[model samples]
Target: MALPCAREVFTSIFKTGAVTKKFCGQLKQLGKVCNDAFVKKTLEDPIYKNLSESAIAKKSRKTWNTCASVIDISPSSSA
Candidate 1:
């Protein structure tokens, strides 16, 4: 389940402003593809799906909390 080298990935999609939201959207699309592929590949693996409900909730909460932390609250913020 290893990925390609970072240099190879960057060479295929690199551009100026590649770290911006537009580029992020591209990455998110790729992420969805990768996630679906992973789930497809691992659906039969009970270990991957054995997490407790609370563990799943904690992970979901952590994701949103981290996203909230990244929000720019100041009017003068460059973000």
Candidate 2:
């Protein structure tokens, strides 16, 4: 993924924001393996030490599935 797209995704996951459709395309291109790996690595962060790993994993799966569905039904855009 491009740096900006990656940053957007990181913010959406760890902070307060949503990933734009443009970045969704990038994430789709990267595929689930990369996405899961990203989440797995994030689970190692100290900030998430107190959080439940299973909960985070479940949420991450939901995010990925939502993005997948959105990209599937929506027309592709240049933005």
Candidate 3:
């Protein structure tokens, strides 16, 4: 995924926003390894250092699974 798409996905997971379908497709293309690494890096950010690592990880997994299901259910589309 591109930087913007990664940022968008991070924001969507950490904050209150919906990720665009186009970005979801990009994420699906990138697969879970990239997603896991991205989330792991985010866990190291000082801003989130005070938060529970396990909770953030659990949420990340949930978000990834949700996005995967969404992308699987729909045909790919442009942003």
lDDT of 3: 0.73
Q: Considering TM-score, which of the candidate structures 1 and 2 is the better prediction for this target?
A: 2
The residue-by-residue lDDT of candidate 1 on 1-79, one tens digit each, is 2233323323222211123333333334445345334334443467556545454334333322332344421111210
Clashing pairs in 2: none
Segments of candidate 2 deviating more than 4 angstroms: 73-79
Q: Per-residue CA lDDT of candidate 2, range 2-71, in tens?
A: 9998888776666556778888889899887787789779879998788777766666666666677879
**Per-model lDDT:** 0.35, 0.74, 0.73
lDDT of 3 by residue, 16-55 (tens): 5667888888988887777778877887889888877676
In candidate 3, where is summed lDDT lowest over 10 consecutive residues? 70-79
- The backbone clash count of each candidate, in order, is 0, 0, 0
Please state every model's RMSD to the true fold in angstroms: 11.6, 6.4, 6.3
Which one is best on lDDT?
2
Q: Give the TM-scores of the predictions, in the order they appear.
A: 0.30, 0.74, 0.74
Off by over 4 Å in 1: 1-48, 72-79
